[model samples]
Target: MEQAVPSSSLEQSPLQQVQARIAQAARIAGRKAEDVTLVAVSKTKPAEAILALIAQGQRVFGENRVQEAQAKWPDIRTAHPEVALHLVGQLQSNKAEDAIALFDCIHSVDRPSLVTALGKAQDRLGRKVPCFVQVNIGAEDQKGGCAVADLPALLEQARSAGIEVIGLMCVPPADIESAPFFALLDKLADDSGLPCLSMGMSGDFEVAVQLGATHIRVGSALFGER
Candidate 1:
């Protein structure tokens, strides 16, 4: 596991380097670098690391658990009011209300039940957070995304329940060439008429941006291994 760095060291260099790489990849793909949003994955990382990134102008962050985010982010957000928090891990239906209260976006809405729960939460809270439907592009049994065949129905269900379905998200199979999977996700987003694709992580985010990823979740590169 990688440990967190001190806040004093969280300068613009790390973020600048990543941004430069993203720009290069986007240029190669004929897309503007500004079109891709970099979401710093802060799972298992300390609040200090997040603060450091924020100091460097990182406005977006991804967290893997509702409980963990709840423990640290409320205060953090209070200090940095412009930050946007995203839930990028498997979310239980029972935590819908809590998730809705904390996150500005959700990238793991992969089932009809979660849609219903989130819709109800939105109605109750009078807030509509953008959501991304996770697709099981790799068909991995252990993954949390909706199966490829079930995507359309799940999307329709989410829309009908008053959830704002903004885009599609996926985690490609690990230890394999990811461009093909990224391309597939882009194709799926195009076919569905969705505008956002939240794929790619620390290792393959550049490839993901080249393949039309609108949002890339990066953790280790920004923080450290965990």
Candidate 2:
């Protein structure tokens, strides 16, 4: 008879599970898993948890709140200087400066005014922080993103301001699968000449990847429940 394995030996760590998921998604997309970045959404997760993930070779992470990030940044930076941090959530006008200082990328540039504010902040910091134009693909009232029709004009304005518009980002309504939303963003990216598409999360990332997601913002799947 085969010996039974212990639970401790069988259990996968959060980071391992995340890497597996990324690999699976990439396989479905016909792309290498290394080609897609997994931005571990570390918003409210503890410092220890983040460190544990870092120890497992997960480098990129995303955070939602500026204040929460501010509380976590010092230690995370000190311990993992190579880690790339992204602000994947909404940026308040008041926190734009702090966000620019903390994140390598801000993935939620939804409004024209926010773009202007980020441009000013980037100028002050003397660094062109990469960013994504958030699109409300589902047209949900509560979400913050530029309307689909406004994207072209917005990209044009951003280009003229010298802001490096690297890609498009969006969050589909809670009930929607990410395929359609991601496909729409992919179309928009094709039209705008941008290359990156930031979509997908814990529940729908597989769909996002198959639809051509270059960057996926995965949360609970990596960190396990908020």
Flag regions of model 1 displaced more than 4 Å.
1-12
Q: In candidate 1, which residue pairs clash?
A: none
lDDT of 1 at 207: 97
lDDT of 1 at 204: 96
The lDDT for every candidate, in the order shown, is 0.94, 0.86
Candidate 2 residue lDDT tens string, 90-165: 9997788898888899899888788778888888988888889999999989999999999988888877767888
- Once model 2 is optimally superposed onto the true structure by TM-score, how far is the C-alpha of residue 55 displaced, in angstroms? 0.6
Task: Please report the candidate that would top TM-score against the real structure.
Answer: 1
Report the lDDT of model 2 for residue 49.
87
Q: Please, what is the TM-score per model?
A: 0.94, 0.93
Error of 2 at 112 (Å): 1.0
> For residue 171, what is the lDDT in candidate 1?
97
Please give the TM-score that candidate 2 achieves against the real structure.
0.93
Candidate 2 segments whose C-alpha is farther than 4 A from its true place: 1-9
